[model samples]
Target: MTVDSRIIYGSWNLEEPTTPTRSRLFCLEPIGLGTAYVESLTGYVARLSETHYVETGMLILTQIGPLMKEGYTFDGRAGGIDKLYGRYTRAFNGASNWTSALISALEHLTLRHDLKFLSVLPWVEVIPLRYLLRPSRAWCPVCYQEWKDAGKQIYEPLLWFFDAIKICSNHHYPLCTKCPYCQKENRPLDWYSRPGYCSKCKEWLGTNQNSIQTDLGEPLKSDLNWQLWASENIGSLLATAPSLVCSPSKATISMAIAAYVEGTSEGNVSSFANKVGIEDQQIHRHIKGKTFPSLKTLLQLCKHLEVTLLKFLTEEPTVEDLARASARLPQLKNSTKRESFVIRHNQSSIELALKEALLENPPPSVTELSKRLGYASSGPLYYHASSLSYALAEKHLDYERVRRFEKMRSILESTLQKEECPPPSMQDVARQEGFSVQLLTTTFPELSRAISDRHKEYRQMLKTVRIEKLRQEVKEVAFQLNKQGIEPTRTNVSNCLSKPKSIVMQAAIEALQEVRHQLGWEG
Candidate 1:
């Protein structure tokens, strides 16, 4: 595909489809002033060495170098370049400066031949080499070979603009420009510095509100509609890009994963690396070797993968999938569950160490137990203790909570063997069985302080509920007395209260219910 240099010159200044128009093309527009013009497709930019300052210089050479011989006209120049020197040479007043410009021109032209001008901002996107080709001139950055239809040429400025956005110093919203804590650290480039925190001793103290947002200057967001659009378009941008490699795989998988998990395409190996606190190279090496990461590395992987490290490094995932999982894992419960698991694993491990120690002449102390077991601190043992506490409470194991539950079971069995029916009241049952209500409440049934508090609340509600039931029972008993030709009124109930014995209350309640049933007043 030979691009006629003359065609470029003719279209250069025709009427740019965009502003900040290709200045290099503007410089050559007049060289084809007398030729028959071909009005380019609306957004076509002239053969572009890319929009870089250096590439523009190459376009100046290709567009002007040949035209200069016949005496090219001087005109369309933007932002100071070569004079229309005798053609281009005559315009230069001094030999040294002209030679310097000549050298810059040659150097630029050489570089443009292989230049892969990336069109992107902080995160870059490489412009396709095809979009950048021009057979007669340098290449045109605007001509995309993968056009939807031959006749309807649409140039996605946003595509090019985002590249510019990534590299530009001005867009301040996706990331803040001023770190309220440290004014020095908020550019897009600063993102790699640290998960930035405020230097100012504010309440957040070492915290950052780092949510990526769109640039405020943007009138609309591409993200809202880009999902479906990307379903069609990302394939073009993603086709086997080297930067996208996750081992031998193209970046599409990483990008697809990030979209699924993070609801965006911000996933790439480097982004994963940053979260894991390992250089991308290390992760590449680990996965490339078909190896699993160490435990610490596993946790880091989980931070971004949104899975536990065990699942991440294991051959087959063991999922404990549930909604509100994020809520379930506050530091307290997570640490607690972790402590229990660690304690159980360690306790089994510790028993082995103890057996070995007992084989020696002198057994090791509890402190030495950890050293022999290769544990870093006594904290692991303490973590185990906490684990036991929960197990004892839930009665899940025959440990603490289980011991109390069983003890309570034993007492109830013994009392039942001795008496036909103990009174149902809490104090009466305790008194008859030689049990202390306080000890029973606190120990054998061992409700933790939290459970005790919860019970207190339940007791408050039960106070009203229990009192009403008791009153109904008393009424039935009194009615039974009346049916049997004895006084059974609220006033007569004082005698039962005065009698002071749970057995008396029991007899009264049973008789009342029996009488109430006969009277068609079910209790």
Candidate 2:
């Protein structure tokens, strides 16, 4: 070639040069991308902070928070930071608005579009948010230890955040909620949280022992079997997220349930419900696309119907496949007996029971009334006395509404009466009372508003107090630096404070100027 041509060209093309765009943050690849142990978004944040040698809260407040449409704020106080990492942080790994926002912000920072797979956001349409994620952190010590020992990165998996996953599939060990050292339950992510360490005590959470011993009593074989099934299936569902062509929809699950009912129970929804031991109303709601079944309920349905949850959600089964699956389940002898009992009871008896139920001081629910009437379900009572049943149901609903309102009102009033500095937020109160924020606000508008107003005022007061405290500390630090002939500069003064990051630099600069004027060293 050298002899044949004046210049010999290599295989590489030098004329067309390509330059790769840089990411604002490190493009750290998530662990277990398509596996059951995929890294959680919360864990990814913690890891990213560690890589940058900054605290998790600082990373969020400085780099990521500003990018989010709903900006995150911290008052440079411990209490305010605690609220940032409280129960809402659990939603980071779930299919919630918070998760979606975080995913968008992180993808923008890292230029990695696969961040959505770190959460259950892909299945948001089919998975209900209620009871979707664990309230706090849960992990397997053995898994952590093993990963550390193998020189692999320690991370919290998205599977561990699932409220339904109790056991680790690989080790068959129960996941630990409380830290072994401190015995305290940690939020999913805290300001100083790090993977494989207790957020409270900063102790290593992983165990070095080959066989980890737990305080939890041995789980029953049947319970373990069910737990394992749920864990493995949910894990498989997560693993399939990246490969899914389209996100599964509520209609897909509804159609699957409808097909199964049609094939197994001759299109009688009640019969299918009875066979699966789920409420007929729940089945109807699910089939009508009104509400999706919770993850636990969906798993229970899949278990009884002999269908994998992944398949039940992703693909609709044929009639023959449903029939075969139904054939595998044992005959429901109790269901048949209950159905016959309901049929034999006279409609007159049901009407009489409904009339009596309406007269009770505290009305019994229709289901309870049905049980008292020796009926398996409320369907028969409604069928026999439609108008009376409707009236009774409506009355019971009214009673429930009043009772719940009073209970929430009482609790909220008590909360307001407390002398705690920095009153609890309405969200926290709602969570403690086991109600939704909307329900709390709508049911007791005045009380909810008062509580919210009190919290806002207290928070504002705390912010003012903290800023003053920070300013004083900065002045003292600057004075000390000046006495030492160190030139009371911003950097020097900051280095002298106990928590320099907590002070607003602008405030610090003003304080430093005041100190300099007092010392007759004005620039």
Candidate 3:
């Protein structure tokens, strides 16, 4: 069969469909200026389908080659092709790792070249880990809103395809995996799926206020941040997929693991695997260069070690980096659930330390001691060294009682010496100081009686001074009004004094009225 070069080029869709002097054929240069990343596989398919006036993704996919309508799952897995919807770059055909079927699809269907489809999908050529691609779909509501507002073409970013990416660093909020209206999960490839909207309900995929909630407690927050950290780092790596010259090797990962575990239990494969939430044999194989870890496992291992994937894969960890990774040993150990050995070590260390401290002349209280020793709870001290711990607690209680009595005595002396008014009642003073009234009375009965007697005297003194003050204010207001050639009427006095007529002090108003009558200004 003698094939013409033009026909060969046409079959691969590498040549322009129609070479006109002015206008070029429909070569879908990514809907947006997607340089390094065009759009997700689902998004790219949808755009092409829309352009071809097709209703389903399967129709567009089948147009390219022998793709089964049911087999186009879009879950980044191998189906009829080696990587039908996966992140693999090379299309292996039992012999070579070159001809990518996805690139071929873009070429044939869109009449575009493979290089034109670089950012369109997470090709294994770009991302070596297909396991990082999520089975379901995720979207940032804020990113969608920003795109819509900016009138940019709506497309799913390749970053959202990663299962590790949950939080949107740009929005500082988590991505929505489920639809708010339909309450159904979004899938990568569906029959009538559209980007930036729910397939079932056709609702906009923009996140709402309700989606940014965290059901996990504070203890799990570190884990959440760790996941976010992974998402951010991986997203950054994917952003530079076009310029990525080197893919990470097994030896690079082995070196990072060795550096991370140099001075810790992680040096042991069993311990490292346990901490990384992977099987020991699997970790050992990766370490020995017998196998490579899946993208998810590698991410977990990096997250556990507090090291970035890019740095670990690219360069050897520095001494400072190693020191920092080692420092995380204590924090990481504290953050996780402890084994029997860790618990025993902590208990014994805490007991011995507390016993040594108890021998000091001025012993510390249990709460203060707990803080100083970095113990989250003092229960261990009480459980392990009950006699010494309890004795310390009892001694502190006695000291606290004496201190309270002394504070009460000072308060009583200050109150009695106050001559502006009489002393307040014991209950009022106790309330002011945030002390229990019963506790104060029981501790200082004599002082309590003195406060009560002084409170009565203070009330009488306040009554006399209040009346005198009111009379003086009324006289002053009247005198000023008369000087201004205004009658010292009740309304005038109230207004001049800046007092509301309704809330004018009754005593002051009455006094003004009496003075007005005496001054013949009662009209």
Instruction: Identify the leading candidate in terms of TM-score.
Output: 2
Each prediction's Cα lDDT score? 0.33, 0.77, 0.58
Each model's TM-score? 0.16, 0.64, 0.46
Could you give candidate 1's per-residue lDDT for residues 248-300 as a string of tens digits?
Answer: 21121221222222111121334334444566555444422223343234333
In model 1, which regions exceed 4 Å deviation? 1-305, 308-405, 414-523
Clashes of each: 20, 0, 9
Evaluation by TM-score, superior candidate among 1 and 2:
2
In what order do the candidates fall by TM-score, top score first? 2, 3, 1
- Residue 6: error of model 1 in Å? 99
Residues 270-371 of candidate 3: C-alpha lDDT, one tens digit per residue: 554565677766755554446777667767766766777667666656667767766665433322434222223365776777777767556666656655
TM-score for candidate 3, residues paired by index: 0.46
